[model samples]
Target: MRESPIDDFWVRARAAVPTLPAAVPEAWAFGATATDADALLSLVLDGTKTGTASSLHDCEADGDALPEPGQLSVILDGSDLPRAVIMTTAVEIVPFDQVSAEHAYSEGEGDRTLGAWRAIHESFWREYSQDPRGFSADMPIVCERF
Candidate 1:
């Protein structure tokens, strides 16, 4: 059987970090599209992006477990190649409209303002969200700080 890139990446990452678990964590990219993934990943690699948000409805629908503090994740690029490993420092569930400006700033997108964050996320979710629930002002958002 051919070894996946993620498996190979995990081997290298564990070698460097040394403290990572023997089992690899989940690997994922940032956004719906390759372009979006690359752009968002750039922010993360540059240390400008420390936070991210996801639709709780989507997670539930997909049967994915909620993120928790101390969880490790492998970040993939637009091409689905692992680039970096991140540790979840915090996770909060909040209404979409209630997401804090501090969290918005940590996302490091657009003008780094709540308004920008809302606009960007709203549009992205509306267009790309897998869940039919889509975008809503009061929708539950999983805000994660890593």
Candidate 2:
């Protein structure tokens, strides 16, 4: 089985994340022909898992250091699906951390809100809301447009 680019990226990002308590080894593959942005997040929200190969538009930043606006990384374990893909991107972590701290006893989307996790995802919800460049004590990021 071949590893997807996203998978490869994560192998590297993992080093930065450090070993945490809750970590799920994930892999993703990218098709340059794949659509741009965290469009994958929308697909997942609609309960879609199958991904299509499309032209990949480069994000605003460059290099593996992570872009200011943030770059989307991915992983792919080509064990079964030839088009296997997974995407991970940046989001507001501080607000999420705060919400999690106060609402240890809450319900609903709070279970997976923007401030709920640093889990694997690609949506720049901040682009649509007021949480642009939001950061946590662990992950600090500059606020730039995607």
Predicted model with the maximum TM-score: 1
Every candidate's lDDT: 0.95, 0.32
| Model 2 RMSD in angstroms | 16.0
How does residue 44 of candidate 1 score in lDDT?
Answer: 96
Runs with alpha carbons beyond 4 Å of true place in candidate 2: 1-81, 84-110, 118-138, 141-146
How well does candidate 2 match the true structure in TM-score terms? 0.21
- The 10 consecutive residues of candidate 2 with the worst lDDT sum are 51-60
TM-score of 1: 0.96
Q: Which candidate is the best by lDDT?
A: 1
Task: Assess every candidate by TM-score.
Answer: 0.96, 0.21
lDDT of 1 by residue, 1-146 (tens): 88799999999988988988999899999989889889999999999999999999989888999999999999999999999999999999999999999999999999999999999999988998879888899999999999
Write model 2 residue lDDT over 70-143, tens digit each, in one string. 23323332232222223333223223323342222211222444354333212333232234333233333322
